[model samples]
Target: MTGASAFPRWILPVMSAIAAGVMLALPYNYAGLYPLTWLAFVPLLVAAHGRSAAAHYWLGLLTGLAMYLVATPWMVEFLQRLKDYSLAPALAGAMVFWFLTAQLPAFLMLCWHLCQRFCGHYCLWFFPVLLMVFYGWFPVLFPLQLGESQSAFLPAIQAASLTGVYGVDLMIGISNALVTAGALQAMGWLPGARHTSGVMGGAGVLVLAAWLGYGWWALDHWDRQVSQWPTLSAGLVQSNETPSAAVPAPEPGYSRSWPPEMALSSQLARAGAEVIIWPETRYKGYFEVDQVPGAFQRAVAGLGVPLIFHDAEQQGNGGEFREYNSSLFLGPDGALAGRYRKHRLVAFGETLPLSREFPWLVNWASDYLGDFFANLTPGNDRVTFPVGGVHLVPAICYESAFPGHVARSVGAAPGSPLLVVLSNNGWFGDSRQPWQHASATVLRAVENRVSLVHVMNNGPSTVVSPSGRVLASTPFQERIGLVTDVPYTPAGQVFRSWFTQWPEWFAVVLGLAGLMALLLIRLTRRQA
Candidate 1:
């Protein structure tokens, strides 16, 4: 067996980049390919084992670009649909997104390079900790994580209940690192690699056994627990309508036609729905807090059930006017129960980056970017609406992608809370974005141990159980109402996750360990 010298200098890095990308993308594109993720990084790690710092950076960037481009080519179509961009501009925007996303992998590879330089072959063991630390903290446009590829693998993701997604990432990372070590040793890349790989492989097997054992127990436990809990009969309306390119200005005192979602809600109520949810911005008109229009109020009161729906809200007057993308809750009496303004605005789509702190940037960008710049103000609080004996915590679109944000909101709610995510995937058209968006909620449900109802425009509206199982879902690009009984902990019964209480604890511990490793390396050099 020969080392890097046996192959052309460029061969390993290029092949490894494409191999890792395809492996990572497959699980996301097809649920059954999840097993590939355990070995996904093996190619990249082996390729990077003896690379220089500069080479590592380029390899990392190439790998990341390949992964996202393959896994989320939908982003380009989304930009064209959302912004009405021509092909060239849409592709340019997607490239910017992909490049920004590549930084996380670039940094990860640079850290691995440093570890190898300092700690010799033993640095392979440190790879998992490094992965947990970096992936947990790295800022990216989309939070499509390595662990999320296992969303369909129920048992593998059970650890998210205790340690969040990072735990699953660490497990997968360990497998890849161990496999990479063995491959390197077999290829004669490093001295003493065989012994290190053998010992780690044994420990890795034991760790995996414990992980799956816990997962098996946890799945059964959650299944039984959910069945015993009280249930809320909820209806989710998927209107399957995209917002018109141009909304005509309202005529004074003229009533708008009943939207398709409203008609769907009426039918759902007739079917004995206790509450009905509408996807984000389903109502095209603006709403003022506590000032429901007469026709709208009458239509809602007619349903005879609580209704949760998304709307645009405006506050203040004249120069101080602020617009918000908000979720509104209406009681059975048609009175506004609560309004949750979206706290997490989509970057660039909902609001321009740095626009709040630097208002001048908004003005400057608006001059150049025109209609691409949105001015929706972010809300300051997470609101929980009480319906019947249960509380519904609302997460609008992009907010559901954030585990900590969703967990904190669920934890803040009194009694058993069901997370209701309202989204308008219509902007992304019939693309992988809808499926990828839906997959994220699976992790959020497990991380918080809360049942979640994700209702989206343009389909794939789903109800996820505490066990991360998709209990019910609508077909993509469908117009229908998905009605289901969502289980929740009864009032006075508490269901809180340790990860919810301290979501960042695992990442913090890993970060500290990384710092200590660097210190040890420094001390070793001093002693020598």
Candidate 2:
């Protein structure tokens, strides 16, 4: 192939990215309807072939950037719907999305390429390890993480036991790379493929078969495991509220009573929810400190059930003000029992990043930007609330995407409480944001061998089994106050768990070794 005809170098990455965008719809919104998701990143991985190590690195970077932009516009749309009275902070809000999108993918791409080089054909193994570090375990919005696409195939996701959610992701990256490599090799277009199919082609096919088989078994096991759980009562509430300057902003965005105009605790108890969950910010009037009386205490008192209330707390006012985006747990008796201050506050929504260094910019920017910007401070600890014989982990909003957090919480013993997510999706305004968040919750549940029960202010708040089953979901574009039963995930037979995450450290080491191998190959090739 002449230099002029060298595949144009850029086309494959773009095609792959577009494919990725389409593929991303599968995980939660439309899991398994299309075969496209299974092969989305393959084109880009193929694009990595025949390029120098540096070229491969650049390809991965560009591909990742494209992927993020395509997927996370849902997040941008959701955050943007939070209309402000001014436009500076609003503009800053939009800019923040771009900034976050660019930063994360760039870092992820760096790891992707490093894995490709060091892990070589083992890209699948190393790629996920790096992805978890930069995306899963690390703190970030990650609203559109890739793992959500596998929601259609719970058995496939079953491997999460050993590898964690990162395993599912690793499988995706590896599958993409292998498919791309195989297709190119088959067409006799890849380097050395025309001369020798015995090595590359056989290796690619073998890996593909093994993963496919494993995915099948995982799916089977997942279905069986899911069948064993006793369905418990579950209720996800959608208050259908939004942030608006014209509406007096509710002092805090959420109060126990707002839109839908009902007593949250009363409605929840009447519905007979063994565990009742309110959407994020549903209790913005609640507080962590004394001078401020908790909002839900009175409303929930004597309900004889545990309730999860999302709210915002004011530390003080007038020059001494501090903010916390918090989730409060109230006993059936109407007393605050446990609290989890949101750990991953939205940069433009809840609080601004490094506001002290850029106070003027933030203060001016938030008028139109988003809520409580001064971005609320994150909680320093994780709390598991006691809810009727379960030790439920409280994850406010974005924290549901992190596997390590959920896994640690589930380590409480056999039959721990399911992961509970409380979120306010009104800011996303019926966009794909709620769906995106819903998608990530599955990875967390399946990864940690627990169930996840979520309540969102908008639609898509729902329940998922440890095997990735969506037992129930709220209707899209509607408000709901529901109560249903869900199982307390069982802790028997650790036999088939996929991601145990026991291999994360090893994956990391292997990835680094791959990087070193690439450097050595380049040096030796140059010397020759």
Candidate 3:
């Protein structure tokens, strides 16, 4: 194996691609085998050990293409919902999603190649740092990083609050790199093969042990601390309702109304629910304080409990009305208590990307393609709603995927220790997307150390604790409401407090320092 002729070149790249595919399938797909994520990249690492820069570049792109292609078939579900679905549109959307999300893998492998070439064997441990830096900046929806897979491993993921999801991502990267380095040495791919194997193998085991050990201690400590905190009885409502095929264009004050289920509200109240939640757009009205219907107001007034729902409204900017995806909160008095407008709009679904820069293209696309979506207004500030004793960070629809946005919302109201996600997932149909979307709430809960309440239209309403544990959830696609006492504890504040002041600077510095070291080493070699 020491000689180039001893091993086939294709072995490394092929194994690398297969490992990446398996890793994505296990954690992201319905397999639910998240533990496999830790070892998923080992095969790739082994393949990459003796590779040249050009070889690593192609391998990285290939691995990224495989990872995203397997992990996110759910993207095609939306395109398929088009008027009489065709393979062309679905394939087109898949290509866009793959191109955007695949950058992280390509960036990661580039880091590995650079480290191996300039920084030598010791740089294996630095791969995680570089990966973290790149991931911190990479823009994608609901970042499904390597570390988020270990969300089920409570102790291991407890570090998320401190570094957001990047900390856990770093740990996974470090462990994988260590294992890869050791394996390469054993395969006679390194300079001091025998000695390096002992060092790397022992280091990898120690790192894994420490990671698990830290998790156990954190969980045990958090459990004892949380036992003293008071819990809240929250009710989540899900009605199997899909959006109408003919969604009317946004006009000035176009009001639509669908009364919420009063029987379910009464049942939840009778069961000691102080707060009741309805799924996004369950009530189809452009509600305003002065324009709310008398019957709707009277109905909410009679409920005797605070209610949370979503609606759209017209905002006047020089007499032009812009619509927003707003989270509406109604008090017991049937009056608007608070509102949080959705900030993160879905790509090409609500608002077109880069439409601000290329305004003419917006009109061009609309004219040619028949206006697929209305240009909805994105919110500027984080808004919190208070119902009963809980202050809620209302993450509407796709906002749950952006951990930093959710964290900033929670950070805005330090007193507010809860996050509520209202989503209308009917657009995605019966695909695995509902479950995949719900997974983001788990990471959000851990990142902010808050209780997360997810209410969705057309199923899978979930209640997650500060520990990232799912306490209660409605079955997928079920038309039923769920009531659960979501835990209230301050375990995640450790990361929250740290992140609020110093965001990703630590990761930035680590990545920059590694790059600088690599550049210096390359220069020294050139000078020699």
Candidate 4:
């Protein structure tokens, strides 16, 4: 602790927070810096060494705040656009979200400090295990796991196929923890065996090498396997229109006025697209299942191709009426083929947490925030749509972030279904939000060994191969149609990834092992 006081007491923590924040944020903003994430936590870890639990907690919170602010400056704009909040209120709301997210890191630091106190230098081995458990189970508004930062690194990320993102997270955490231990030992802050830094550094290098080797082999194997699967030409349309909830739906029996997306769909259909996909909730109206809208029916018929798009749907009588964010499929004949309601709804944006139980909170919050808050009801079924001899599993917006949910959806459907993620990123406009959102698709594709097509209202719309390769992508805020040949398992051929079979297995094992180790440590100390 004395050696750590070379500078002012606050200087190391502040500097370490800045360094870790920038390193972590850079990968999300610029994909090429993904490798920086391998050591991103080192600065914070090193600075936290020999610190009190309270100090570690504050350092972790500061680092988390810096990371969020640097990575998602667009959040303030999102709040402003989403609720029409003024500058002050929007900034305040953004800070609230930052503070809430900071708790995860704060808890991690506190737990790490306690482990160090009990286990001494052996805490290095437990650090990654603790992180794996936290990242696996800790709930966050947005699940930005450390593994996703390595989404751009296909070789390293291939580990996700076996352990579902937790494996890659564990790998990165181990490297950071080991490096931090080495740095502390070299600085004399940690009294350990001689050449401890060299031993730790060598261990880190070996772990990284094994991780990359496994990734390379898995990528090659999956790539070959996907190549032999049946292929279909699919078209993704990014209309780039920011649809407003305030915009009223056209009256029933209104003229068949086609949106710009219809023209794009027509062009894609003419170019031999078998199925055309659209972003989430682009059609701004209630789509009654029985009473099909003439305009929508005609538009789909005009294309002469299967169409998949998002729309709001209402069901039940007055008192029991509920609305849903849904994905609907239209057959080539322009008839309702299949519909899947969104299962996951965004908090505050789509639904208030306890509004249903309290009911009055909705109205009070709406009046306070100057925004209407009609919560969208969540769907219970994992519905899949059949398209051109292949089934399509749909995930709307935030649902794509959950690996287990997406995997279960794919597993629920017979045969190997293609994952079609429909998202609307217009609220966050021209920022790292879209890119970060899109990065999840890469891991989803790899984790389930399924081809995924992520179509967004604003851009970075992408198509990813089962091997985690970006087959095609569109720039941000562009009105473009990307036509790509998507590969999927042929009908009657079911496929399941190892990770899908046993999701979060790595995290579970690590948690159990950590518990057993702690028990053994306590028993050994008592005996001593």
lDDT of each: 0.83, 0.62, 0.71, 0.82
Off by over 4 Å in 1: 1-8, 248-257, 288-292, 367-372
TM-score of 1: 0.94
Looking at candidate 1, the ten consecutive residues that score lowest on lDDT are: 246-255
Candidate 3 residue-wise lDDT, 67-104, digit = tens: 77777776676666533347787778668778777777
Residue-level lDDT of model 2, residues 161-193, one tens digit each, is: 666655566666656655666687676665544
Which regions of candidate 3 fall more than 4 Å away from where they truly are?
Answer: 1-12, 82-84, 193-208, 248-256, 260-263, 288-292, 317-319, 365-372, 414-416, 489-496, 516-528
Top-scoring candidate (lDDT)? 1
Rank order by TM-score, top first?
Answer: 1, 4, 3, 2
Clashing pairs in 3: 155-215, 161-495, 162-495, 256-284
lDDT agreement of model 3 with the native: 0.71
Error of 2 at 261 (Å): 6.9
Candidate 4 on 180-294: residue-level lDDT in tens? Answer: 7768777888675446556756877898799999889988998888888888899899988764535435534442256566778989998999999989744545355334466
Quality of model 4 by C-alpha lDDT: 0.82
Q: Per model, state how many residue pairs clash.
A: 0, 50, 4, 0
Off by over 4 Å in 4: 1-7, 193-206, 243-245, 248-257, 286-292, 368-372
Query: What TM-score do all the candidates reach, one by one?
Result: 0.94, 0.79, 0.88, 0.93
